[model samples]
Target: MNTNTNTNAIAAARQAHSTRCRQRVLTALEQAAHSGDEITVSAIARRARVDRSFLYRHRDLHAAVLVKAAEPATASTGGPSASRPSLIADLANAHDRITRLSHENTQLRQRLSEHLGEQAWRESGLCPPDDIDRLQRRVTELEQHTAEQRRQLAERDDELDATRATNRELMTRLNRPHPDGA
Candidate 1:
């Protein structure tokens, strides 16, 4: 009998929690609608301070958010106008595109980190792609500077060789017999 009573009490508490979460989600939707904010699952979840998974799991709240999201926007002073539907559609399309792009970005980042290898990143303390790109640019700049220095050094060596040859020729001429038999 005690076990039965405890089970009943636990069930009641879970039900109450579910009810409260649903109410919060609904209230968040209403507030978003009134404020002309974009009606999205994430926005509602954030406003309600509820987990998004909860919103997705609650069928009623999920349907409500979707319906609200599909509604046309209206001016604060005016009711819904004829042109508002198209504007709302456009907004929904943009939101969907943003969501898709965000997912893609996440996937790309994951792939990049995987390709770069976890051990390499840990050992080098470099973030994927960005750090690699920076290092590549630095290496290229250093290579160019090194090539320039090498060319300058070669030029200086050539000049020194020519000067030394000229000096030796002058010394030889001075040591040689003059045309006047000096």
Candidate 2:
């Protein structure tokens, strides 16, 4: 019987505490609405001196906060405007777009300038007409010819070395004493 009574008392205390928290949340929301302050869960929780989870834990309080937050601020307290964080995000996005466009504009100007410069240079008649394909073919031919000359030079060097070796052998044989002891 004592345990049952104690349980009942504990339940009542918990209910009272929950009721107080709910009241505090409602009062805080009302104050915020009147003051035209942003009605976010965190702000309400701070103003109510309750944990954010407390608001979430109570569905009624949570819904109330959502409803209040969605309502536009009255004209008396600085007409409806975007939240600070959202405004900053929008500003950042605009800056990024500006930077991207600036870079694109710079690239376009450079290409245009280069094209105009090339046109002017051509019109000045200072640059001779260039046959790029013919020049490329000539360069390839020269490279092939140089490779062939190098190969030929290497073959001549090998032949010269062989000839020198034969000459040395002949000299050694002529200078040697006759095999018959003459």
Candidate 3:
């Protein structure tokens, strides 16, 4: 690779590492605090496997870390929380709605896929071939929508990489002097 290409690749790798490190640190701090470890400087340092001084140096992040850790988990499928019954109720209602839709779709598709040119099929009073074709088209549209969602998810991942790169650059600049002495 050319020097410029190599340099750019190294910079991108460094930024990715920096972002991963930050996220891992936050996750570790959350788990530690949630599991009843003190969110104090020494406690975090111990949990992070870093020195006490290093933990103190990043004390500003402590409160945010603790707050996020202390908040209840956002997703619950009837786990032991005060509001779990309500969540369960809501889930049950959603399940019923899904079941109804699924049954309706199945019936419609059954009527659709019948033999189009058969006289017996005609007498069976199935949905017209055009309606079946429309339903098939709708299914294709739904599949395309799912593909678009996956593409969007991949794009978001790329953005995360870029954000991580920018953060690494900022941190590096913070720790280094300008080429021209300031």
> What TM-scores do the predictions have?
0.44, 0.48, 0.29
Which residue pairs clash in candidate 1? none
lDDT of each: 0.87, 0.89, 0.69
Point out the higher-scoring one by TM-score: 1 or 3.
Answer: 1
Model 3 lDDT per residue over 11-51, tens place: 99988975665565676777764454445555665666656
lDDT (10s digit) by residue, model 1, range 1-182: 99999999999999999999889998989988887887889999999999999988988889999998877644486775434467768899999999999999999999998977976876796646657778989999999999999999999999999999999999998999889976
Off by over 4 Å in 2: 1-84, 171-177
Best first by TM-score, ranked: 2, 1, 3
Mark the 10 consecutive residues where model 1 has the least summed lDDT: 75-84
Give lDDT tens digits, candidate 2, residues 1-182.
99999999999999999899889999999999887787899999999999999998888899999988877655464656665466668999999999999999999999999999989988998865767679889999999999999999999999999999999999999999998998
Model 1, residue 125: C-alpha shift (Å): 61
Q: How many backbone clashes does candidate 1 have?
A: 0
Q: If the candidates were sorted by their lDDT against the true structure, best first, what order would they fall in?
A: 2, 1, 3
* Highest lDDT against the true fold, candidate: 2
lDDT of 2 at 48: 96
For candidate 1, give the lDDT.
0.87
Residue 121 error, candidate 2, Å: 1.8
